[model samples]
Target: MWQQSQAGWQTDTGAGSVMQHRLRGLSGKLLWLTMAFVMLAEVLIFVPSVASMRLRWLEDRLNTAAAAGVVIDGLQPAELPRAVQDDTLMATGTKAIALRKDGTSRLLAADHMPPQVDAKYDLSDVPAFQSIGDALYTLLFGGDRMLRVYGPIGDSDMIIELVMEEKGLRQAMLAYAQSVFSVSLMISLITASLIYIAINRMMIRPMRRLTHSMQVFAENPEDPARILPPAPGNDEIALAGRHLALMQEQLQKTLKQQRNLADLGLAVSKINHDMRNILASAQLMSDRLVDVDDPMVKGFAPKLVRTIDRAVGYTSEVLAYGQASEAEPKRRRFRLAELCQEVRDILAIAPDSGIDFVDSVAADIEVDADSEQLFRVVHNICRNAVQALANHRLDDPGALRRITLSAQRIGSVVAIAIDDTGPGLAPKARENLFTAFRGSARSGGIGLGLAIARELVLAHGGTIALVEKPGPGTLFRIEIPDRPVALGDWRVRA
Candidate 1:
C-alpha cells in the first residue's frame, strides 16, 4: 500500500499508477488518512494493553503458586503426596514452586525442574516502557525457554518464586494479541467510515458542486442561466459562491451592452455611405447659397453651410466608433481665446434663448495643441453644456442661464475651465462620466459627446475631468501639456 522514499514511506502518487491516482483525489485521501490515524491510536493503546496482559498473567500464576506453596511448606516434604504435588504444579502451570522467607529459600513443590532458567522477572517495580518493550520482544522473538518469576506474596514478607515454561506464556500472549488486532481493525474501519461520511457530506460534496458550477459557467459565461445562484450561509464556500454569482451577473450585463453596441455599429455602417453622399450634396447646395446677395439669405447661408459640414463630421465620428482608436494629436501653437470664441460662434446661442456664452479667456494666452482636435474637445463639452442648460428648469426665475469658458497658462500646460449655470449632473452620469452611452448628464442623451471629448484631450497628452463644487451647476477642467522639445531644437530656438 506504501512505497519507500527518501522522505520515508509514501503512498504512490504517480499519474500512471492507478492506486496513486485514486489516492490523489481528496475523497480517497481523506478516507485513508482517517483510517491511518484511527489505527495509529489503536496501536498506541494495544502496546500498553499487551504489556498489562502479560503482567496480569504472571501475577495470577504467582498468586496460585503462593497459596499452594504455603500449604506445601507447612507439611514435611515426604508427607506431601507425589500425585497431589503434581496436580498443584499442573494447576499453577509451573514445574517448580518455592517460597523465600527470612533469606531462606524453601522448595515447596518440584516435578522434573529444568537445570537452568533462561530469563527472570521481578514484577514488583518494572518501568512501563521496559515492560512494554519486553512484551513486544517476547511476542516477536521469544523461544521455548524456562522463566524464573518471583515476587512478594500480597501483604507478606514471604516471596513466591515459580519456574515456568516461556512457551506457554508466549502462546497465551499471541492469542490475546490476535483478539486485540481483530477488534482494533473493526473499530478503526467503523470509526474511519463514520468520519469520512461526515466530512464528505459537510465539505467535499459542497466543494464538488462549486467546481461543477464554475465549469458550467466558464463554458458559457454570457448565458444568464449559467450564473451561479447565491448559496445560503456565511461560510467561505457560501461567500465564494455569492461573489461568483455577482461576477457572473455583471459579466452578463456587460456582454449584453457590448452586443447592443456591436449591432448599432453594424447598422450605422450600412447607412454610412448613403448618408455621406446626401450630406455632400447638401454641402454643395449650401456652398452655392453663399453667392446670394439678399441680406436675409446671405446671413443664414454661412451658418447653414457650417451646420451641414458639422453634420457630415458627426456622421463620420459615429461610423468610426469602436473601429480604431483616435489618431495622435498634431500639435501646434494657437491662441486659446480664438479657440474658445470659435466654439461660441459654432453654438450660436440665439439672443432670445435664455442662455449666455461667456468667453473669459484673454487673447494673449496661447496653447500648444492640435487646433482641430482641441476645437472638437472644447466644442463637444460646450455643446453638451448648452443642451443641459436648455433642458434644466431653474427654481428661481432670476437665476442666470450662463455657460462660461476660461483659460490660464501654468508652466508648459494650459488649463481651460468650462462652467455652466445648470442643474448639476445626475448621480448615474457622474458615476460613468467619461463612459460612452452611459455618461449622459441629461435625459435622451447618448453621452458620446464627453466620451469623444475625453478621447481627443487624452490624445493631446492632457487630462479632462468634471470638477466638483458646492453649487447648482456643472464644472469641467481641461489641461493640455505642451509637446516636449528636443534638446538640439531647444538650444537652436534659444
Candidate 2:
C-alpha cells in the first residue's frame, strides 16, 4: 500500500510539472494579443468612415436637386413635365427638392405630394462624433419614413433640402459597410501577421530554445551537451541564453567535484572502522602497562592512555558521518567557566610554553549542553591555537600567544567567543574554514578539528562563524539557543 501510494503521488507531481511548463509558454499568447490589437484599430477607423459616407450620399442628392431647380425656375413656372420631373427625382433618389435663400423657401421640383418628414438633420455645424452616431441610428432603426436633410451650398446663403425615403439610404449604407468590413478584415490580418512574424523570429524562437536547453539540463546536469548554444544577436534573449549557459557549466563542474567527495567519504568511512578496532586494542594495552615495575612506564602510562582516548574519539567522530546527522547532545546545566578550564588542562599549556589559555568566561554563567561534546569543541579550537603559537614561537619566542574564552547571554541564546592572539588565519584557510579535510591552517593537518567542532555546535542548535575584526588575531563566535519551552502546557499545569 505504501509503494502504491508513493507511485500515485509521483504521477500527480509529474502531471503538475507538465501543466506548469505549458501555461508558462509565451509564443501562443503573444500571437493572439497582436491580432486583437489590429482588430481594435480597424474598428476605430470603420466608425468614422461610415459617418463620412452617409454625409456624402445626402449632399449629392441636394446638389442635384439645386441644379434642376435653376432649369425649372427659369421656365414659365417652377414645374417640369411629369416624365422629366420623374426622371430628375429618380436620379436624385428623393421625392421632392427645395431651396431656401434669404429666409424664403421655394419648392424646386416634386413628383407628387411628399410624405411628412419624420426626422430632421442639419449637417452644417455638427461634431464628428454626433454624425457617426446619427449615421448608425439611420442604418439600424430607420424604416421607410421620409428623412429631411438640409445643408448650405459651399459658402453660399442658399441651403438645399431633400425629402427622401430612408429605405434606399439605409440599404446603400449596409452595402458600403460590408465593403469596409471586408477591407478592414484583410488589413488586420496583414498587420497582425507582420508583427507576429517579427516578434517570433526575434524573441520567441530564441526563448523557446533557451527553455528547451534548461529542461534538458535539469534532467541530466552532468551532460555538457545540454547547455544552451546562445542565439546570434545582441538582444536581451541572446544575453539571457549566454548567461544561462555559463551558469550551467559552472554548476556541472561543482556537481562533479561533489561526486568525487562522496566516493572519498565512503573510503574514509571504511578505513576509520578498521582504525577504531586497532586503537581500542592499543587503549586496553596502555591500561595494563601502568602495572609494570618500571618508573618511566609508570610516568608515561597516563599520557599514552590520554593519547589513545583522543584517537578513539577522533575515529568515532569520523565514523559518525554515515548517520547523516549529528548525535543528539546530552543536555545538562554546567558552569561555563569550568568547561573552559577543562579545555585549558586538556591542552596542557606549560608556563614556559609561551602560550596562555585564559578562561575569561564568567564563573556565574552556566550552559545547558553535552559536557563531553562541548569539551571536544573548545579543545579542538584551543589545540589549533596552541599549535599555531608554537610554530610562531620557533621563530620569535617573545611573541605573545593568548587564547581567551568569553561568553554572554542575550535574549534566548548564549554567545561564546574564542579569540587567539597567534598569527591570524591565512586567506586560503579562512576560505574553507569548518569544511572537513580542507580547512587546515598548517601543512600535514587533516583539517577535521574545526569541522568536528562545528558539527557538535550545530547539534546543540547553535551557529559557528568567523568574526571579522581589525586586530592581529582570529576570533570564532558560537551562538547556542535554548530549547523552546511549551508555555501553553506550563500554563495548564499552573
Best by TM-score: 1
TM-score on alpha carbons, each prediction:
0.86, 0.74
List the lowest-lDDT window of 10 residues for candidate 2: 19-28
Q: Per-residue lDDT of 1-494 in model 2, one digit per residue for the tens? A: 99999999999999998657544657556656777787788778878888899988887777777777656656845456788878888989888878787788887668666647788788788788899998889888876678888888778788888888899889889999899888877887787778777987888778778878989999999998888876667878888988999999989978876786688789888999899999999999999998998999997787678778988987887656534676799888788888887677667888988777878899888887888888888888778888887776446556678888999988878789989987888898999898876799666786778888898999998998989878778888988887766999679979
Task: Please list all clashing residue pairs in model 1, or write none if there are none.
Answer: none
| lDDT of model 1, residue 235 | 83
Whole-model lDDT, model 1: 0.87
Model 1, 372-476: lDDT tens per residue?
Answer: 788888988888889888888888888899999999999999999999988888899999999988887678987788888888888888899999888778999
Query: Which parts of model 1 are misplaced by more than 4 Å?
Result: 1-25, 76-79, 282-323
Model 1: weakest 10-residue lDDT segment is: 6-15
Error of 2 at 89 (Å): 2.0
* RMSD of every prediction: 7.7, 8.8
